[model samples]
Target: MEQNDHLGQARDVTEFPFGADFQSILSLIGDGVVSTDHTGRIILFNRAAEDIFGYTSDEVLGGSIDALVPTRFHDRHREDVDRFCSSNAPLRRFMGEGREVLGRRKNGEELSIEATLSRQMIGGQHIVTVVIRDVSARKTAERHRQLVASEVAHRLRNTMTVVNSIVTLSARRAASVIEFKEAVLGRFEAISRTNDALVSGSSTDVSFRLLLESELAPYRDDDSKITLTGPDIALDGQGAVALALVLHELATNAAKYGALSTSAGRLNVDWKVPVDAPPLLDVTWQERNGPLVAPPTRRGFGSELIARSLGVHGGTAISSYAASGVGCSIRLPLTGAPPLPQ
Candidate 1:
């Protein structure tokens, strides 16, 4: 080891024994290699170190190693270095295995890095070497994984809440145990179908046409009885789930009492995207050729579910009991919908 006192008076490593081999070895190291004296002054700044810290070897040779560390860690860094140098242990020690430290580049950008420290007594001179590797990419990937996990947990909670509400409402509306069982099982099946559509697509949102098609699948045997008219619009998570529940309730009621209850009855569903700021989708559900309709004396679970679902998104569902049949006019705010010529 070449003995040099203080900064700026640092000597070229080539002047020391096997100095050429020492310099050659430092150049070939893939990770940043920084050697400092007992005083924490840098003595050897390698090529990899120059690339990692965004500094030329000449620029940092006589500088304090603290320059590479973020200001927040300066105190801890100094304490750790001092303790390591004072200890009698001669073996190398790994630093920041799972916990990483921040490294400051020449451009002032911060990086996540892991470091390994080793001390050697060469010719009675204590030389401390630190090998650093950039781990910013790994840290970023870990954070992304955590975020996805959190989102999945949140979605699962919301799904459970919706299922519980369905159970409570189904029991409240049914007169017999068989009726309750059918209602609950049917609604659960609808949710499962909706989830299937959600995952089948590559996108997070589902197509408006697809959402409606899934609920109206059983009635599609007679195309003349079911007329669906609208440009395909995509619905986000909240919108997709809300509209699915609303559609299932409407279809159920129609099958039990309205259009789908009679062969002569017909169901027509049409929607249009109106040209307006904060776009809106105007939909009409009209039943024709069924028994004369009359408003119910009391609202049922279906009515309550439709109203609540639409209300969450500042939308409205108005049921009309015309003598011809049952009809509903729904107005909903649609986000990120492409405006089509109406």
Candidate 2:
């Protein structure tokens, strides 16, 4: 994810810097230093090389340079080494051009690395020194960031499509322009609130209970009569957003004609996960103690959304206007495909 070529020259390992120790200086440098002969045999191995390649000096001192390179790149690595050794450049050649190199460790695991080669002609033998730094962690992190960016872009497009559908459906049910605008704005507000919660959450999956509570927050006094029960599991990103819209529609209808319209009304919402082989989420919405319930003569946008959204989410949604109250159940299969952004 990052590369740099700094200006500096390291002295020969055998040279004494103002009578200071020679090998001690090489051991103190942070980067791995490996010295190889013209035949591609490693003649010098520093402590950093051992730490990076997982080999002791005794094991790798005279080993082929290909020992550090992956098996697939062995041919190319040897050819490059030979070409560098035969080059008619200056006596000291400093190369710091960045490359995505890999090193093979003792355990056979490969890691990303950045290496700089220095070719020097000492006496009559040509020696090559390579400096290496491990970069696997940085690369992995960069890949994750890219994936997050791509996922965010796809989800934003999906959200806009859902918004367009909501606008069209809301317009169909309104008699006047003012009524149409109010219906659209209300649905948009519900969607906006869900998006806010999604941004505030630390993970992509949202807590089911928290989502429901936020949608039902408009009538805080109804909390005393409303009940919610089950293990609070999380929903995937699309599932969370779609369910928020579904719950908002149900609550709006309830305030107009169902349980929430009367003072004595009560509502019970619960969920169950069966002991079957592949357990699924079974959520129920029931209301009672309100005005007499009647089935809708015509399907509205609210009804269509509640009835069809779960099906798109790899699940089912069904409702009944029984003599006592209105009841609905949504079944979401956990092992199946995740909810689509429909």
- RMSD of candidates 1 onward, in order: 5.0, 6.9
The global C-alpha lDDT for each of the candidates, from Candidate 1 onward, is 0.81, 0.75
Tens-digit lDDT track of model 1 for 190-212: 77777777668655567777878
Highest lDDT: give the candidate number: 1
Per-prediction TM-score = 0.73, 0.83
Predicted structure 2: lDDT: 0.75
The candidate scoring highest on TM-score is 2
